[model samples]
Target: MGTKFRSSCPISSALDILGDKWTLLIIRDIMFGKKSTFKDFSSSGEKIASGILANRLAKLETLGILHKGKLPDNRKTVIYSLTQKGIELLPIIVDMILWSDNNLGDHVDEKMRELAKKIRLDKEAFVNNYTGHLKSLMAAL
Candidate 1:
């Protein structure tokens, strides 16, 4: 995690926080995707290394992007949830997913393509629905 931006430019400053490969993936997992716990995250198909995962998690927390909490069912279990700042990344993720699905076509997963098709067919509805769902989930937390 960078302590300072390369320049005062908006893009430069934003990238200073999010430019690393692992950061966005961790954000995506915590904010909208499934994986939450250290174990769950390590188990993802992407297989992010333990050291890298730990570092990224701490960085995100330090940035106030997410917070760690005990699982409701088991106080012993640690889980992570996105702060409002982390949830704000959802639209960016949606855009990236749609772009890759369209531009890369067959290289993308069939299920993801189907999802992308649905999103493209009704982007506003999808965004609105997904955004609402995320907000509700955050509220429930």
Candidate 2:
């Protein structure tokens, strides 16, 4: 949504929005971790640059993948939460975990491997639980 599509191909368009490493990392944080603010993202272990984080957050919002707004209790504090479309990417993340553990086993940690196993054990249940968590968090917003 932030830029013109390079081609009419669906893959290209998706890449336009999510091809970069940082975007999905940002999504990973929001979807799986407690990354809800600019500070949280900037301070993550990935150490995403401040400018890059801001731009990615805005781009995700423009693409309707996230909702950025002020916290209800504190007008000045901000929050970034996933949209319905964003939460739909859970399976993709889970799949990537499986793939990473399979092909890049050395790089994946035991925790991630365990998660991938859990996902493999029951993909539907994992997806349901993750999506339910997202919905409940969004409801609180």
Candidate 3:
């Protein structure tokens, strides 16, 4: 969640909904690979606190960015998957990755460099194809 705001410029409004550092990183992790449980997300390098992670997940779910479901075999564990609205943000993430790669290449892996190059070449196609793959996986679940 975020601090309350007084009025709404649409851009400001949207940012307010997603302005927190932890929130964006959480979305990034989900977009990249972490999407099954609190454990998966907590282990991501940003080192989000457990209580904060739970709150942010709840917030994203409320904002329609994520949907929660139970595993078929184990009702105690929950799976978090991106909604179409959430998947729609992939191009934005891709662009951020490209920008980071340009500015911070030395620390990033060769595989990531290659993947970022591919993502930069055709961001829309990459996102569209990835979105389709996620949807297919969701259907299979």
Whole-model lDDT per candidate: 0.82, 0.89, 0.80
Question: Which residue pairs collide, candidate 1?
Answer: none
TM-score each candidate.
0.90, 0.93, 0.85
Residue 71, candidate 3: Cα error in Å is: 0.8
Measured on C-alpha atoms, candidate 3 has an lDDT of 0.80
Q: What does candidate 3's lDDT look like per residue over 33-128, in tens digits?
A: 646688899898778899999999998898888888888899999888788877777777777788888999788768678889888788878888
* Number of colliding residue pairs in each model: 0, 0, 0
Model 1 TM-score, all chains together: 0.90
Residue 70 of model 2, lDDT score:
92
Q: Compared with the true structure, what per-residue lDDT tens digits does model 2 show for residues 23-108?
A: 99999989877789998888888899898899999989998999999988898988999999999988888888889989997788
Better of 2 and 3 by TM-score: 2
Among all candidates shown, the one with the greatest TM-score: 2
TM-score pick, better of 1 and 3: 1
Best lDDT among the predictions, by candidate number: 2
Candidate 2 residue spans exceeding 4 A from truth: none
Q: In what order do the candidates fall by lDDT, top score first? A: 2, 1, 3
Query: Which regions of candidate 3 are displaced past 4 Å?
Result: 1-6, 109-111
